[model samples]
Target: MAQLRSVPSRSGRGRTLLAATGLVLVAAFAQAPSTALAAGGPVPAAPAADGPQLSYVVNAVPGAVETRAVARAVRAAGGSVVVAYERIGVTVAHSGAPGFAEAMRAVPGVQSAGATRTAPLRASGTTDIGRPQKVDLKQALGQARQVERARGGTAAGGEPLEPLQWDISAIRADRAAKVDDGSRRVTVAVIDTGVDDTHPDLKANFSARQSASCVGGRADTSPGAWRPWDPASDYHGTHVAGTIAAARNGVGVAGVAPGVKVAALKVSEPGTSMFYAESVVCAFVFAADHGVAVTNNSYYVDPWLFNCRGDAGQRAILDAVGRAARYAERRGVVNVAAAGNSAMDLAAPKLKDTSSPDDSTPVSRTVDPATCWDVPTQLPGTVTVAATGAKGLRSYYSNYGLGRIDVAAPGGDSTQVPDLPAKNGNVLSTMPGGEYAYLAGTSMATPHVAGVVALLRSAHPGASPQEIQWLLKLEADNPGCPASDATCTGTRHVNSHYGYGLVDALDAVRR
Candidate 1:
């Protein structure tokens, strides 16, 4: 199974409520409609610090003059600018000085400034145990031959399609294939660790020119730069890319939109397994600028499970990532994100977060949803996807919340009614080094939705991102919660666990 790293638990007190209250006061003071001060004042010098290097995101009031002023403020605060997303008025920076965020916050035209993480640069104590179990190549080849014989040896691309890919069939992708095989014009950018575009299943559809590495806030667009820096860390992104747009060449397995294009936007660092704000910010802008119609984000912006806007540090992250996403949407990209694997109610009033500040020694703290956000997923216009088992039930580990989840897809649940074919229940897709594997997580569920969006874009070439989103919710299969299930929340048509309902590739393509 594609196991997810469990968050280590630690004990601490709640200061979120107090911090949120303080944020209100700051906002009131900043927005109090004060008279303008006289111009030509001396610019404040950047503050110096005596600490280890840390990453920070600074949000400035939109415009050329305001952005330039904030960029100056970043330098004054002893931070070096890494990238300035001029369109969104957000700048990513690195700092080694103490009180860098506080000093930048005091600058004129700077809306928010905060450290991107609580840990020092390159800190390495956290570990991820989740690894993909490789499938036997000989056995897989034998199964492929058997599937070919069953199809009368006339399957497209000569090789037999993966017969055990029930996850694909469950969403009616095969049925959709009979009508439309997707278009090459549409591209789905996999914004995750990194994709192994050399995998035979992905090579045909992979767009090397559009791919890039955004591991450190800046993008490297050289050929093959978007591939995994370490082959060992390539499993997650390769698997996600396969699910979304693996080629139709009768090789390993087929993708949901096999005819569409796939691009790799490497955002995770080589050793940390963390997707920082700067890298993610670079990814959004890159995708939008490259004509990507959709993006699949299987992981959340790391270091904080919830970035509460009430806190200056967390608010900076929210502003930076939020602006990047909105910019992508404006440029015609639909962003799809996993709701998360924590199984907690995202709509809950108060929840305890013990995995925060994940780059450092994490301490538990209570957070309120109104001020805190599970970014990218909770960001405006994102299609937040929940996971479902083969039995069409919510995946046990999927986080759910009424009005929070936008749609559901087959993510596979190994514990479900075990009679289905490939009873392992985890979603199966291509892995690194020309292998295939079974993994389960809301992470597996997200690409299914992204693929369907690609199908919609392919069918309705002129449709806007908003139009495609509306069509997805309108055509979804409404599998309301079981009448006796207490864990399920909300009404039948639209519920917390199965938002809208299971995403249907056939319905999307037909529309």
Candidate 2:
């Protein structure tokens, strides 16, 4: 069966968390069973969400004029508006009333309406992580520094862990940094779990003005609103932020686009850590409206692993997120998303999905890949990224497809260890509490590409989103498919396993 594939990465041989579907948590997940076609059948129709207090996304035409009409209809349908994102035609609502979605769907300008989750609302707890070690990489990095320090030459006056960050050299970001470290004018939004901007490596480049928490389908701009809900467990966003733009401040580690600014638009729910539809919609709209130049989405819009269009509720969630992504692109925000960590052929026909409604007990259902889509990443205009290892081959857990993947980058692989200090093959980056850790997933790969995109945006300030994406594909270094794998297909330049090939940060800046 197609189970939830959240492969979490840890600190010091620990795991990194990938929330919802296509994620991390310190384990390998296999693809659907071989009997998928034989056992899978059409999914049963689900009743309208009229039983419990659930969040709903009511999409209208992108304009206040049309949004006003839908808001009025939402109230009449016994629902209150959580937030109305007129910029992207998405209005979030909370309603337990019978047929709330059905009533809103009947409204004149409404395009789509559906409940976001099966689990009812509840407060999740946050953990108090132990105090961070005193900031001193000299003693902590003892011997590994002396060994790999010679191999990993200093770039932008490199950080202490630069010698251990084999992921950086895997994509040639170290060389790219010399040409251009990116511009502070551009900001890449880490649209995932909250980020710990207070981390030493991230604070210098963290833009508080552009950061906000879009947790409950609403944007909260309070102080540290963008910080992680639980630093110990929710360090996913912080680790991701570190890779994208953790600053080249000779402290711990350097990010791919060290000069670029990073903003956190957290969408994951506190306790559940699920990336719901309404929060995702808010993130896209927020990134677009803000001065963000790029957005990195490491997780799929959840509950559903692959949301099928046949289901009315799933279709609405897909449409709402699609609109938000489209809106961001139109406003010059090029979005980059991870191509999942399930190791499934996204281009192939999918049969059984056993991960829908992940917040509650899930039931198996038949799905068509042609109609069922992975949000943000598979959506048109978004960059779908696959993961590569230090050896320059596809990461064992990354999802790939002939036409589905846009590019590849080093996410990391425990099996493909290089002669580096970290010893753990996972990508090294800043964790919470001013510390550093190693994690691997397509979740880690997306940031490398986003960082390169940030460099592109910096070098070509006049380029449009489409232009940046085009340059990204053209600049990649394709290694083609590995010989041992016969399941892979496509040519060297554009294959299922590597897409446009490994992302070249060095080329992103100079070209």
Candidate 3:
């Protein structure tokens, strides 16, 4: 019997604590069994030494059109590779044969050999029902809740005490004064775990033009695909879509561009390997081909975990993402990607013989993970977004470096306090089945910036992707962090940790 498992819903608060406690301490969590998939495969008799037991990984030849020949090779090698996810163009397996790694590498059309791993699709944490928060003028523009809807009630002490509600109307009004938000519809292609189209806020953002479910073709825009309140595959994309373009309707949370359209593209999920670089490339092609102006991706794979053996498979994927993004850029499409949540550079906690920062003390040094960071995002031609706390400082756990991160966005964690206009508690958006949820990560932050790009595209219809990126970088507000925080000295202009600075919607629009 095949072991099956549902994706785990991680508490955002718990994950923030786990990530911030310390890099050395956090390393253990990275090796923990990924909660992104359902659990019910063949039980492993013994686990691997490094982390959880890894099942077989099948490699497909780069640029090869024959997926069957690749599967046949796996079968001939005594590996039972099944489930060809056309979205990413890879296969999964039960186990590997002796010397299977070497044999797969040698097989024609085979790119490389590795194990199939899962990633967490939902953020972990409970909603702080009693935490005190501050609402800034920017977030209070269009206050939705009158005295009656407040937590306490219409009388004294009845304001909604938890799940901080951001006044999307206020944000919209404030932004509108600076720019025009006409019916200029911008389409964002979300390449991640499928989306929850039934969610009220999200329904407004989804487009009727065309949406496809690569999640075995079983998923649709209906509420049933996501049972109860959540779906078994991935709730990541839905939350992201909501943040980017949840409708402006007064039903739920408002997205950055609530009036814009969202193109749902399922590229990540449980029981599936990440879409190869080629698939990502193809996604860019599809997005541009379909008038998608902005592409949001929140999924990544540890290159080292797959042994970092680059072949045609890797090159094709990289070429697809890079070339396609470039093509999109020329065509006025903006690609927004996560800088990855790993605290350190690509090599991160484990640098083999290389020197790593001492966890006991906050340190700063120049390091480039492009050579080692996960693929697609790290590839050239796109904007890589990092996370920021409520105080306009870089999150302790966000990966940093000038070369890697292009800008910073509000990816709130529990430790984040409500700082003026910025709320670090959580960004609430639509979930599956017409529900609302709170999730945070670089995944969450990418869409925030992507939505901003959409808004920019709306105002400046002919703005090139590179020009928009330059405008974003140039107009970013500098949250003066003096030589304090023990992390670095001097003013952080374009550091990796915080990038140019936080995405100032107000500022971006004014530009």
**Highest lDDT model number:** 2
After superposition, which runs of candidate 2 have C-alpha atoms over 4 Å from their true positions? 1-50, 122-140, 149-156
Candidate 1 lDDT score relative to the true structure = 0.73
After superposition on all CA atoms, what RMSD does each candidate show versus the true structure?
7.4, 9.5, 10.7
Sliding window of 10 residues with minimal summed lDDT for model 2: 29-38
Report the lDDT tens digits of candidate 3 across residue range 191-297.
66557776767665676454543332122334333222225324556767777776655555557776678877654323332333323444555566568888886
Query: Could you tell me which 10 consecutive residues in candidate 3 have the lowest summed lDDT?
Result: 1-10
Can you write out model 2's per-residue Cα lDDT over 224-292, one digit (the tens) per residue?
989887887677788889999988877788899999999999877766457788778878878887889
Candidate 1 structure quality by residue, lDDT tens digits, 1-511: 0112111111110000000000000101000011111134323324555787777888887665776676677776776666566667777666788888999889887888887776664523223222455667777566656655665775444324366677888898877877776899999999876889889999999998779888777778778888876666446788888889877776877788888999999877665467778778889988998899999987777678788988888999999899899989999999998887777788888877877776666678999988888877889899998888878888777788889899998776667633433446677688777778876777788899999999999998898889999999998888788886787888878999888988899987776
After superposition, the stretches of candidate 3 with alpha carbons farther than 4 Å from their true spots are: 1-174, 182-184, 215-233, 270-282, 302-331, 345-370, 419-424, 489-492
Better of 1 and 3 by TM-score: 1
Model 3 RMSD vs true structure: 10.7
> How does each model score on TM-score?
0.88, 0.88, 0.63
What lDDT would each prediction earn against the true structure? 0.73, 0.75, 0.48
Clashes of each: 4, 17, 30
